[model samples]
Target: MSAVELNPRPVRVSPLIKFTRWSLLGLGILYGAFHHNRFSKIENARREKEEAERPAREARLAAEKKRASEAEIKYLGELMTTNK
Candidate 1:
């Protein structure tokens, strides 16, 4: 009946359980880093590329629209002159 007897039934965790716990922790950290860092950077790059191209795309579209309008006006002017 000494100190050894006092804690004879000390809790012991199984090695398999410890390994599983650590493995899950490592997987969670990997998942978080990939999702928050890698995937986010990829998404940001795509968005930036799209944003950079948007003005050019809009300008091209505006130019096309302007050309179409000018052609229509020219056609109408020719029609009016012929009608007169």
Candidate 2:
């Protein structure tokens, strides 16, 4: 009878796997450096623009109110002077 022997195979790492790992790490770093702050700045600018428009909006509302009051007074005066 012949004796049989079994040998364990060595695991091999592919170059593609190493490349993918490095690429993913580099992409993560670049995304954080370039995109994070830009998004924040855009958000801040949008907030500031919205805040700046608030006063103009309030002024427009005030003008509309004054115009309405003038119209009411004119209407009351015309009604008082009319004869039915």
Candidate 3:
């Protein structure tokens, strides 16, 4: 086959098909944006809740650590006295 015979003319696409394609693309973008906005709001609310509870959580942990330290010291003192 010759090079000229191998080449074919480009088929023209209908204007209606092009319009439909573009419209669908725009709709997909809008749908994605809506879902993204919803997800972001939920994520932000979760972050705010975590931040609000941080101080209480830290205080509880610190109190637990202090109690454990005191118990260790008392046990050590008792051991030393028994050894003497």
Candidate with maximal TM-score: 3
lDDT of 2 at 14: 96
Residue 8 deviation, candidate 2, in Å?
14
Query: Who is ahead in lDDT, 2 or 3?
Result: 3
Clashes of 2: 0
Error of 1 at 77 (Å): 0.5
| Top lDDT hit | 3
Any residue pairs clashing in model 1, and if so which? none
Give the per-residue lDDT digits (tens) of candidate 1, residues 1-84.
Answer: 565585477689999999999999999999998789988899999999999999999999999999999999999999999999
Which is better, 2 or 3, measured by TM-score?
3
lDDT of 3 by residue, 1-84 (tens): 665866688889999999999999999999999999999999999999999999999999999999999999999999999999
After superposition on all C-alphas, the RMSD of every candidate to the true structure, in Å, is 11.0, 9.5, 4.6
List model 2 lDDT by residue over 1-84, tens digit each: 336537656678799998999999999999998898999999999999989999999999999999999999999999988954
Deviation in angstroms for 55 in model 2?
1.9
* TM-scores vs. true structure, each candidate: 0.47, 0.44, 0.59
lDDT of 1 at 29: 96
